[model samples]
Target chain A: MVKLFAISVIRRPIDGPPDGRCVLLKGSYDLASFGFFQRASVKEFMSFSSQTIVERTSPATRQSVKEQEFFCHVYVRVDGLSVVLVSDIDYPSRVAHTLMTKVLDDFSSKFEWRSVGPEALDAYRDLDQTLAKYQNPREADALTRIQTELDETKIIMHNTIEAVLERGEKLDDLVAKSDNLSAQSKMFYKTAKKTNSCCNF
Target chain B: MSVIKKVHLKGIPFNILPETLLLAINMSPIGGDERNGSNFRKKVVIIDENVAELCDKILQNLSNTIDKDDLLDEFDIIPCESKLNQSPVIHDLTSHKVALESWCVPYLFKHSYHQFLWICRKSRKTSSTSSSSSTIQSSNSGPRRDSGNIASAKREKELSRKLSCLSESERISKGLLLSRALIIINPELTLAWNYRRDFFHPSSLEALEKEQRFVSLVMSRKPKCPEGFTYRKWLIKKALQKSLVEPSRIQDFISQEIDMIEQPIRSYSTNYHAWSYRFWLLELVLTYDKTVVSKDQKEIMLDRELQKSNTWIKSNVSDYSGCHYRQKLLDCMLNFCSDGIPLLLKELDENEKRIFIFEGHESLWHHRRTVILLSINHLKKCKDNNGSNAPLSSEEYGGLEALEKTFQDKESDLVQQIESKNYNDTENECSQLNFKLCQAHVKWMERRLKWDLTKSVHLEV
Candidate 1:
């Protein structure tokens, strides 16, 4: 079974300096995991994910990552807005990208880029229902099926989390640099490292 | 290998397998899975450690191979057996059925449901006790209470007593607390909101203010919920109704509502509900306390409203709802204008300026059409009244004629602008459509003017 956990849209700076901040316009997580994702830190993680995906992929390309048991797919539009879908590993990457594209198209048609905000997101709450509808792989649209077939030959799969990191860098560096990381996470990492290195209790 | 007679499974609960099989795959490995299989069945021989690992691997393979339905069918397990039994303990199965049932519900929902039930019971108990005490006291006061008049008097006393109890500030506060909790738990619960509404008097400004704050709280949680907006509107109407005695409060209350709407509109420009509520509010303020609101004050308010609408239209040129609202504002202005022609001309000038800037915007053009039609209608009315108190100086009369001539010129100018911009054919089609609409409007205006001229000529003859 394919389980969609969260979907988010982030607005990147268009034609500005590369280091400009990307704003998260709107996001919705599955109701079952809503509380877990509602925390500011988790939202920060989602934004970070979108930002990294945008930086990694060309405007026309899509990117996917396999982290632990979860799969994340990101599609970047030409206008610097990125739609990110995070789901269980069993979810088809092509379907996720297709869903992202559909959402991006629907959203842009209904609302102007300048008018996106928390209140604006209320108008698009039906997007959550779309997420729920596409959870079953059999319900994938024709475009999604075509993309899946094409992706079977050309898609690049990243089997490990390290695919997102630079050569000579570790996942720890990324986590440490992320502003979204809570203080508790840093302490936990330190304690875990210490426990692993030392045999004594 | 030895006979391995009657191998015993240890640690796992007797009901674990059945519960796991009955529930969906997502809810597998219920609570008992937390405890390792360390408890053994009574009177069984121990197996070798290697054999135990082998047994574990075989069971895991079986779980993966056989679906839940097939596994249950092969084991002769009944799905409803656990649910049918309400007992807390089952000795044969060692099942805590009640505990498991409670554990199945989500934590937040369970807690909120419990609180809701507790509040309901508490309120029921209080009402029952109050009613019983009131009856006992009324009976003890006089046996003649059986007569109709005496009974009504006794009932009146009881009602006053109950009102006095409810009127205590603490009682209202408690009701507020419970209602707030309930509303937060489920914003869609209209009954809870209604109960909360009873806690405040319609005329009490302080209570209305508190209710407004409470509404904001609920709105923050569910911004798009119509119920919250409807309640706020109802509150405003109630407050306004009570403010008739003190007309000064009406303006303040209306301004407060405007402030509430302004914030949301800044973020979501096309919120029709917010705009509709604003229109309703303006109507109330204009009509309410006509005796208290002086003519000068009404004019000032209308002018202020006109300026605000102008700003909104400039920012949201394509939002027809805002344009529609501007029509209403202009109508109000015309109704109370000392000299309607000059005001209409000024409005026409403003709208034309907007049209020149936003040439292809349909809503702006439509607004211009409404303004021109209303202006022409006003001029006709003025002529019928023998131009009494007319502000149409010769220069202004020339301006009005110039405005009408420019209306036709504007349409052709827009078509030329669209052509020069080198837009796609589909856009060309749309502009052509707009041009046709403008032509139709101008033709209608001309016919009305000709009809009026013929009537005047016949009258002269």
Candidate 2:
């Protein structure tokens, strides 16, 4: 029942121009979960998670938010690369972190950190195989097994995005700060907000 | 993983190809091999050209010699000279022939009417000749004629018994039993499926109903198999073609089909096949039975169907298949109702409420678009038919305006609710979701109103 819907590798700028964009390295979504995100572009998905990262003032680097019907686990590596795993709520958090770590390690070894672009991402198409192999959490790799035994305290499970964000931080401010959003997506969010003003009545 | 090896052989008929014969060979695991878990390694042996020719010759000879009566016998494997003069390469050919014979027997028995008549003629001639010889009253040949007469009577009785045993109804029932057993073992067997279709008597309602029940049983067992659904569709068409005498029965059959499909649709959320079949049934009923189902009756049925769909959509908000079927049902409803604009407006209102409850649900939005288009079409048709500037009824216009006002009121209330919630003290996820929902509702209503106004302008033209 704990099916992995999608795994995406996104590259975020560390100290570049304010116009830093999040590029989708490789992503695979199952057909069953196709309905939930059928209209959402990769940029929208990136914006959803990147917005959370921009909002967080605390030292906690990992977050899980219920998006649509699945829990999207966002694990931001030290070098600004993020591995997002979307799975059902029942999916093990430790397994998700381990899978992210393995994928990140494999991705980093195969591609240069500074040279993160479409070409660099294309050089590592084998990551799709890793995504498929790790879909079954029971088939965890060596790191997953070791972490489950030795580092139980490192896993931080947040019930919602708000649980991790500071009190003064608003989701809207974070969304506005996200640089990955396309013009069309921005217009859509604005239109959606305008229509949602019905709540004000 | 153990690798599979393939060997291609030529000059074999497509029906007796490697894939078909491999399926016939029953392979069971011999023992547990600790590494792979099974000791049996599945192998397909492709015989050389010589064996293929020998197989063809053996089959041809068997077909020539084996009559329908010989096939009906329990253990009689037809003997061919090809088998008697077989070489070492074709030693296992006899078993293959036996298997093929048994497999082909049921098909031949069901279809070979010429063989049945041939046996009838043979029995009738023997009986008549013997009876005629005895009536000649020749003293010297009296004993011989009497003996012949007794022999012919016995032969005639045997032949008649065999003929009754292979009667059409009996053969069909036997075929049904065999196919049911065969399908249970391997539901993908197209040959078995095709063979079963030969037994369906189109005019017999009872036979058609039984076939429906059997297919339902099959679908319940193997929900993913398309063959069962196809067979069910064929049965429904046959039933419809025959239901001209009592057209009400078609309605009953359709209702039963809907009831049957509800389980599969609920169990598997996006079963496109079941949804397609439901659409087909509705189209058949609405279009095919105009004389049988009166206008009033069709309206009532459509209303009931609409209510049923409303319940389905309420429970299954994300299932696009259900939403698509609901749109089709609405299209059918528009055919019966003269004032469809109000109905469409009401549906649009309901869809907005649903989108508010379940934000970012794309199917609901799609359904709203469909409703808008249907309303526009209805308005155009009404103007064309009535030749009036104001195509819509005054009451319908009043209903649309009232619905628009209600949407505005809901939007404002949602905004007030969001504004009143304390940002810091509230549960972040709940408040954020509510905010997003409110935004989505407002956006959808804005588009809905714009489309409605555009269509209303079209009505003026």
Candidate 3:
């Protein structure tokens, strides 16, 4: 719960749904409580995080996502390239935003807006390793934290999904209608929420 | 010699019997992508028997490696997966993606893998004189001695067959290491803890200290696990036996222990183990060994706890564990000081802003209910002390009258603000939850106030 669950870079179009299929790096997450099935809830959490980024309206905005116990932070640039960092709620916001801004800037400059090739990806300085490194922010953030003098200016720290959503839009209705999540994931969301089992999920 | 990464002694995930799952940790945050990482492996190959022997060997080797001067911070667990990280160094298993991929864990930690290797080789290598025998001894530490990692498929099959042939006594001999490994992997393994309980010599401070460090490592990964906390309590209980630890150092030892246990409570909320451990420890601190933990020292500890719980509650508006612990702390403090009443009032005053901001949180309301109940008890205490010779006049009573007036006024203001929200908007669910809880609090308070007036009147007559 203290670690970052997943990290992804998405390319959003002005009017259409965002293309978030580029790269998704997951960490060593525990789903031991699910017992029989995998708690790859982080995977579901990853999809949910990317979906939240896709739903954003602002050209350049910073927002927080509190879906159940998970806290996914998003930093969308004016260029439509957004970096998403999904972590446990206890993971600090300051470190998360700093890591995201650095990642987006680095990724934007190094590689063109095309999908990451294995060679192109390997060429970039640790887009993958940065995900693995920042899992324990206390240990890793000190060395890897970019010197982007971010002293908390304009990020809107929304408590829940509804806080960031447009007026009158329900999280449940959006989850039901979204094309990003598969039907099975959508149902699992409902069932997991109903049982209140999503905390570990 | 570098910083010790965490050791996540995890059991290999179920339904897969790969010899061991290798945890490759990056030396630098951004190393040659995958070429460089300290490698270690976790084995959950066979259940209840053969794997026990293998783990016992690795566990013995690992424990001995970690136990030398008890340098825990020197070891780290490997957090990166080996596949995506195709280290030319660990190239063989880099192709075997299924092993690490099938079993997914939440976080990555780094451990002292080289220590394990060094110890195994040292244990095997007596002198410069016979190096061949070293390979045989090293094999026991892992499935293969080639890289200090898991063996290949064909070798793994042969090893499991060989491990099954080991005698029960032989397995039990190294059971100390096996027990620790399994306990760290799956803390739910109660029998492992029970088996290891007698493993340490009672008189040896060194053994207990080593165990204290070991349990701390286990707790870093599994703080919610009861077995780790239970085992820690056992170790402390043993060490606390009159002559076991130095009498002067007992207080220092207990405070250090408190700092160790308190980390999990702050890092992860709703941790009853940390709070319960604190309560149990407090129960000991408050009552036990009067010479070292003096009366005034106990009062200081209670004051410190009140401040801690106050801050803890402010940040965690929804955590019931902190609130409940604060309740116990207040109850204990009342014996030492009458200021629990004012402290309770200050807590309510601080929470007023939080209550206004996060109206839907039930824990906030629940905490308010507890605070009011405690204040009422405190006032009753004041009245009892004053005696029934004359009426318990409001003017003479210490801040009770004003505290009640301030609380009631704040409650009405909160109610008015909550009522103004359009609860008819069915789209917003948390607001509905907030409204219901606020109404319940008001109802509960009205009932308590009525009880308070009647009881005081009865006492006066």
Q: Please write out the lDDT profile of model 3 over residues B309-359, one tens digit for every residue.
A: 777776566688888998888778766664555566677777666665455
lDDT tens string, model 1, B55-174?
233232222222211211111001111232121111111110101111111222223333333344345445656785555544443443456586445544543453345544655554
Give per-residue lDDT, candidate 3, residue B194.
Answer: 74
Where model 3 places Cα greater than 4 Å from the true spot, the runs are A1-11, A15-52, A55-68, A73-201, B1-57, B68-173, B387-403, B420-432, B451-461
Residue-by-residue lDDT tens digits, candidate 2, A13-85: 6666655655666665554322111135433754466445433412226666665345777777667777777
Docking band of candidate 3: incorrect
lDDT of 1 at A118: 57
**Backbone clashes, each candidate:** 4, 14, 15
Per-model DockQ: 0.02, 0.02, 0.05
In angstroms and one decimal each, the interface RMSD of every candidate reads: 24.0, 26.6, 14.4
Clashing pairs for model 1 are B10-B39, B11-B37, B11-B38, B11-B39
- Candidate 1 lDDT score relative to the true structure: 0.54
The reply for model 2, stretches above 4 Å from the true place, is A1-201, B1-175, B383-461
